[model samples]
Target: MTAAKPIRCLAFDTSMTCPGVAIIEVRKGKPTIKALSHVKPNTSRSHAHRAEVIEGWAMLFLDKHVGTAGFDYVVREDFAGKTSRSNYPVLSAWNACERATSRFGLTFAKYKKPGKDTEYLGISATRVKSLVAGSGNAVKDEVEAGVRRITGYAGTFANDDESDAAAIGLAWLIDAGVIEKPKGAG
Candidate 1:
């Protein structure tokens, strides 16, 4: 018998200052992190320049991977809807990601903050943590540790942003049934 093909997923944790991105492959229902990186925008640059930098990087990453095996899914962690006043940059970056994903003819999923509603398709943050870290209340460090443990990834991440991207990808895999839910998960 031949083995089934793996599902490829690209995930992002978006921010104005630093955004994280990861590519994962699910083979035999186990997810492996293929690549992970964080993009830091130059703070001294104007908003337009920073946006251009982010958009360029995002497109380059997608172009590099989308031509490979092609992705089965794309996901981005949704921002916490605290107040509309402070979320413009995040929303802008997220919109760029959405546009890039659409350009590749792929539909991306947005994992939302718990119990919040938004126009975009969203899954709650609690659910993501539960699926990825085995606890809905898991902190950033714990979530990062869980990702490391799950993928056996040895490389160091610049910050929790990268790890969070990995976690977001894992959550999507779990939600898609590409990966099994971990024990004690909420």
Candidate 2:
């Protein structure tokens, strides 16, 4: 029997105030985050308009990233709070990511006939945090440290929401055994 190919993934966070993206390329047994980007919106502008701005950014992100072997699953964060989530930044973030899900689905031709579809996973921030930091209540800094601990990334991670977003994808990759550990642990 032949071996299976490692799945590739592109992950991003939708936020007007803290827009970020992360992509993971898993080839063979080695998996690495190929790209991570996070940016702060202009202070002069409020996040209320992010729905539109993030839409544009989503289009740009897909235009640049989507391809033959597009993301197997586009993992993103979701909220199920009872309160309306149409707040400025929150609303904009949702709008931006929603576009990515639709586009990624089409890009992968998952919408074709039947039994063939690319799916997206909207992970809760708590779950993702727990997977990485071993605690759902892990703060952003703790999460960042966990990322570095796993990936050997050394930097401020100040704008690393994109990196963290991508990290979730990596965790899924590891959990699914699409990627393996480096060895010499315990």
Q: Which candidate comes out best when scored by TM-score?
A: 1
How many collisions per candidate? 0, 0
Per-residue alpha-carbon lDDT of candidate 1 for residues 1-186, written as tens digits (9 for 90 to 100): 988888998988887788889998988777888988778999898656777777778888888878758888788776666777567787877877777777878887654444556544545567778888888899998898788777888888889888988898888887767787777666
Model 1, C-alpha of 34: deviation from truth (Å) = 0.4
C-alpha lDDT of candidate 1 relative to the true structure? 0.80
RMSD of each: 2.9, 6.0
Clash count, candidate 2: 0
How far out, in Å, is residue 109 in model 2? 14
Query: In model 1, where do residues sit more than 4 Å from their true spots?
Result: 110-120
Question: Across residues 1-186, which tens digit of lDDT does each residue of candidate 2 receive?
Answer: 977765776666666677777777766666666667665656576555645667677777777777666677665665455565445467557666676557657431111211435443355677667666667787877767666666666655556676677667665655556665323211
Report how far off residue 57 is in candidate 2 (Å): 1.4
The TM-score of predicted model 2 comes to 0.71
TM-score of each: 0.86, 0.71
